[model samples]
Target: MQRNRSKRYRAAAQQVDRAKAYSLPEAVSTLKKFPPTKFDQTVTVSFRLGVDPKQSDQMVRGTCPLPHGSGKQVRVLVFAEGESAQAAREAGAEF
Candidate 1:
C-alpha cells in the first residue's frame, strides 16, 4: 500500500530522476541545489537488496572507524593476554 507523503516531500521527489543511478559526488551535488530550510534536515538513503536479509549467510556487517575518536569515553571488554594486551594498550586502549 502507498503511504501519504507531504506536499513538500512530493515536490522534492519530483526533483530527482527515479531512473538514474547517481555516484556519491553526483548525489552531494544534487542535494546542494535544494533551497535552504529553517530547521535542521537529515538525509537518509535506503537500498532494497535481492538477497534475504534474515539469512545468516547473507548478513551484512561492516565498521566505519572514526578518525579522531568519538569524544565520549568508550568502555571496552578485553580478552587478550601478554603481547596482544600490550599491543591493544599501545593502540589507544586504556588498560
Candidate 2:
C-alpha cells in the first residue's frame, strides 16, 4: 500500500513538472484555441510572480493565472440581481 501511494504521488509530481515547462503565455495561447463550452466557462491558471518585498505586499505573489490574457473577448454572464448586478456591470462585467 505504501509503495502504491508513493508511485501515485510521483506520477502527480511528474505531471506538475511537465506543466511547469510551459510558460504562462504559451499556456494561455493554447487554451484560446478551444471554443467556449460549459467546462471552458471557468479556466484558471496557477503561477508565481516575482516582485520586490519592499515595493509590494509579497515578494512572491501566487494566484490562479488567467488562462488567457485579460480583456477576454467573450461576454460574461453575471447571476447577481439588484445592486449587485449593477455593481457587476459597473465593473465591466456583461450579462
Candidate 3:
C-alpha cells in the first residue's frame, strides 16, 4: 500500500543516495542533517536476517552496550498506589 510521506520526509530521503551503501558514520551524519520534527524521533536500526522462525538454533538475541550511551532518553511508566508509588518515585521512575 502507498502512503503519503511528509514533505520533510521526502526532502530528507532525497538527500541520501538510495543506490549507495553508506558507511556507518556517513549514514549517521546524513540522519543528523535531516530537518527536526516537532517532537524528538527515536533513532532505530533494524536488520532483516533470513533465519527461519521454526529453527531454534538460528534464533538471534544479544546486547552490545555502547561505551557512550545512546542519545535516546528512556521513559518508564510505573503502576502503583500509595507507598509503592512513593517508592517508585524515590527509585527514579519518571512517571
Scored by lDDT, the top model is 3
Question: For every model shown, what is its TM-score relative to the native structure?
Answer: 0.45, 0.29, 0.48
Error of 3 at 16 (Å): 1.3
lDDT of 2 at 9: 47
Which sections of candidate 3 miss by over 4 Å? 47-61, 66-95
Residue 90 error, candidate 3, Å: 17
| After superposition, candidate 1 runs with Cα above 4 Å error | 1-11, 48-55, 65-95
lDDT of 3 by residue, 1-95 (tens): 99999999899989989898777788899999999899958787755677887889987889999877897888878999999999999988999
Which pairs clash inside model 2? 45-65
Q: Output the better candidate (2/3) by TM-score.
A: 3
- Score candidate 1 by TM-score against the native: 0.45
Poorest lDDT segment (10 consecutive residues) of candidate 1: 44-53
> Can you write out model 1's per-residue Cα lDDT over 1-95, one digit (the tens) per residue?
99998777777788899899888788889888876667899788766667787999998778888787777987665679999998888887775
Pick the TM-score winner: 3
